[model samples]
Target: MCENNPVRFIDAFVDGLDLDALGFKRVKPKATGRPGYDPSDMLKLYIYGYLNRVRSSRRLEAETHRNLEVIWLMRQLKPDFKTIADFRKANRTAFREVFRSFVRLCRELDLYGRELLAVDGTRIKAVNNKDRNFTKASLKRDLARLDERLERYLKDMSEADTRDDDGPGGDASAKKLTEKIETMKARRERLAGYQKTLEETGEDQLSLTDPDARAMERNTRVGVGYNIQIAVDAKHKLIAEQQVHNKVSDLGLLTETADAARKTLGVETLDVVADKGYFVIEDVEACEAAGAIPFVPKPQRGSAASKGFFVKDRFRYDAKANHYTCPGGQELTQQGGKRVVRKGVHVIGYQNRRACKNCPLKASCTDAAFRKVTRYEREEVLDRMAERLADRPEILDARRETVEHPFGSIKQWMGQGAFLMKRLDNVRGEFSLTALAYNIRRAITLVGIPTLIDAARA
Candidate 1:
């Protein structure tokens, strides 16, 4: 009888024919002649850490020394903390490939539906704190403070110099103040250089702990360390994730994530849904061009329509004439051939000051001296999109149900709001592993454990 045997769980869970079958090896021929642990054992250690929600390397080291499941899984071998940490850090690229392979296997088994995908970005607290973020505005404030201190030091120095030779201490005080002023000036110049770098670099924000990460506001009252974006399939809620720098807004993320999912699933096209944040006109067009349908809400900024005033939409656009006919039956023509690009469409501005000033509805039409109306050259496309969304309002509700589930579950499981790894590459690698673990758990839950084992064997 195998009753009360602790090894049963480990044997049943992690016993494998060969780690090399999964493209992992225990030894490298190029390394020095030293006793090395098996790569399979390290892989098992990571899997155990992910499964038990002990993601920190140090914590995993502690578990290997004391925890029963870890002891059983690793065969009572306790690797040092440096070894464990080095393994994860050095093998990040290989681990990502392993994650991709698992995703491929899941698709082959028909686990991922690849029909309906929800795209969303959630803020993951970065390893860097908010205080480390150096924006141009912050740098300016720091320089201003330095300038005030320098002025005070100069004033003190001048006062000491004006002293009527009362004591030799006056010269010492003058020299000390002068030195302080020079130090403050040098600091100010350094800050100026930092500010110049901030301006020259296209990145809107930077992180001290992770140079590639950006500090972004998560909500009105809260700020996050980093923003991780994911596109999850509705069928099993398996994550298709990629970490991005926080500077870029969500408006451009829709097509990128959807395209990644399509490529991963080897599908020609798919349906994607997201909130208003992803609703850039160019992104919608790009998704369509990529053969994917994006169901994202158009962001509504308060316009004249919302304020109960005459909006540009009220005016009828004469496409052939390339002009607008106002409500008062006045013709508004394009002025000075000036145009601006909005949402990837050229918007030609039209105005008629003479007609607008004399119209009965001029007060409602213009708060400006002249009434101006801007028409997008591709307004017809936007109109069609709005109509389609109106027809299927339930898509929004579906988006909420599909995308929030995985985010909520992962956040709860992680216990903390931040990432453990510093730097963008490390964070991305960690996230990839987390996503793999999530997909595996989902697959195991949807299909029985025995079925997964059979598929793995097959």
Candidate 2:
């Protein structure tokens, strides 16, 4: 193998790590039983396989015999396909630790800037297909359609029974209709059972193949998959932290992802920026409390925005006075009671009903008697963040530029658009290797394999 080959760096990197401490199994060979392949060697094989875009265990087994790089990297030990597959399934959770170990090595090498991070999520198709996934709403819709068909079939059968032209063909037609009706009834019963399961479990959707996968919408296309979240450092666009979630949306994930990345980077304070999907107040507040400064644009979501009326942001709030100056130059003060928006979140409604009775701007402001602007109890945090965003608006564009590179490369260049594993943990392990390969390639491109090998040893 050449000195600059990434296979050499992979060997050096795995050799330096304590696999037992990182949770790899069978670290020590047994005394009485058959000898097993060393975990470090297996780890090197996987890293090499992923880096070369050959992820299947059978393909990897073939590589050990045919490919010169795999033969040299693994020392010509070709574990069968089942053994190779079992290694990953048995030590699934440990892959994340290995990924973080490499991240720590990169941090030591100054590959991470540790100042700012861009957080985003993408939906990767799972082993489950869309037809095999069902939500409560979909189940109900299917049952209703079946019921309509059943009604039509029953009516046809009744009309056929009244016919007096006795013939074998007529009887056969009626028998076929009866069979169709029975099939539809059986399907209806099955759908009802699914509905009952959903009600009992309190889950929004159910996936037959992979129970951990969910039906999620991405880029206006709906599919059954897992949401993959990543926090990328601004300097190198390398992923600092990655997590797989089955959630349908990215509402409350900013804090957890950014906090983990912040801890991995070993920074006291870090700047995190995301898109409007992560604009939940509780999440942003939690992210800030976790020592990350978050900048997320508030989404324009409300009846007013949908109806072409003035949005809540148009009314400027005065904290000291506890009132808002509306677009019509009128003061709207907080009303008497506070309403609970969500858990640990309360908002007070503000309105100037007396002034709006005759104001000419009422039509544009609201269709109701007056405009009511609700303010959260912790609205000051959002206000401060909005001020920060206004001052440094370029960070939003920076966020887009920083996070999209890794996702695009992983999906487009790496041929990892869909996961091959069945369960969540297995897919997580698979992605961990994918991410590790991506980072390794990037580090080698930035600073050659020789430096990485030296750093690994150091």
Candidate 3:
């Protein structure tokens, strides 16, 4: 980065803050061993590196030797890659605190809009390769292939032995076959180990490269990575809160992210706008309970608009009479008290076979003799939320604008590939670094570096 550029603002900001006071863990002094690098210097080096778009620890170490700006930032002390890497690995909590510190600074500057929080999630690919990620099905297939290969080898050896072959070439072939068998057996054992691990941990899949990484989809492409949940403020389009999870979908993340943004901005009441994927009944209810008015577009699942069937949401739920008032003004009373749809979620089946028999809209509703509707006991909360959501189409637009911009900027900074770190904790710290760096860049762009420098000093 240029000496007089916004990079300077990062340096000034880091210089001004007492990292220890912000709960940044410091390396304890060793009485006898060689003196360790100062945590502040390492932090400054990382901040400077990330701000300048140089992310590799090796690159930072290289910068320490040759780059004038990095040398100045780290006070000419060139910490090796191990030291730098170890610092990041050991100080995960400290790195998170630094991200929050920058957020607090942003709040102090009144940069956060704070009111309209647009929540969304982006998939960040992990260092783990898709091929190295193993599922139960993959394990079974691999074992079958290994068994087939082993059987072929055994059959070939048996044929060779029956031919009474005793020449050097025959002996060599037999030896090679034996070696292949051993190798296959070892591989089979390794695969069995992976299978055992899967059974023991009860994980759907396991990534060999990065144990904590998971397989997820971004847009349409599926890969091993994390769902990086973020809540962006609509006013200035700044990220107010962030979380990284291994979950593949955003179904249950709405409330947690909105509430985190609420706490981060120190606001009692927050209005969160998110896409359809974030529309979960429990999450929506949680948001309202936490004083956040959520505007999430309901997900269209199994809605047969093309099939000419009215969607589930079109049917009005009457909480007072404990029945569903269908679009054709038919009352569907509960047939079952409660049925387990999935773990922790229960639903009651409502149906009116008599009403459907003579209804004119039955053709448009369903082809079955009776249309059955399932409702959760607490479905009224969602009905009320959807009623409020009906008039707030603009909130979804705001959500796209606010959240996508920061994701683009941050993705650019992270380079074409995903995280550089391996495991969850290290990746978290790495992401925290990226978040802080991006926020600093944004803060500098919003107000000039001069203003931020002044504020940091003040």
Which residue pairs clash within candidate 1?
125-225, 126-225
For TM-score, candidate 2 versus 3, the one ahead is: 2
Residues 230-311, candidate 1, lDDT per residue (tens digit)?
8888778877545455644676788887887778778898778888888767778778778677777766454666666686
Q: Write the per-residue lDDT of candidate 2 for residues 194-243, one digit (tens) a residue.
A: 89999999999989899999999999999999999999999999999999
Better of 1 and 3 by lDDT: 3
Best by lDDT: 2
Tens-place lDDT digits, model 3, residues 270-368: 898888898778888889899888887776676455566888877777778888899989888999579886667788999999999999988889988
Which stretches of model 1 miss by more than 4 angstroms?
1-31, 35-39, 75-77, 100-113, 149-190, 199-203, 221-224, 301-345, 350-355, 375-381
Backbone clashes under 3 angstroms, per model: 2, 0, 0
- Misplaced by over 4 Å in model 3 are 1-3, 28-35, 144-186, 302-309, 340-344, 358-364, 367-369, 413-416
Distance from true location, Cα of 412 in model 3, Å: 2.4
- Each candidate: RMSD: 4.8, 1.9, 3.4
In angstroms, how far off is 330's CA in candidate 3?
1.9
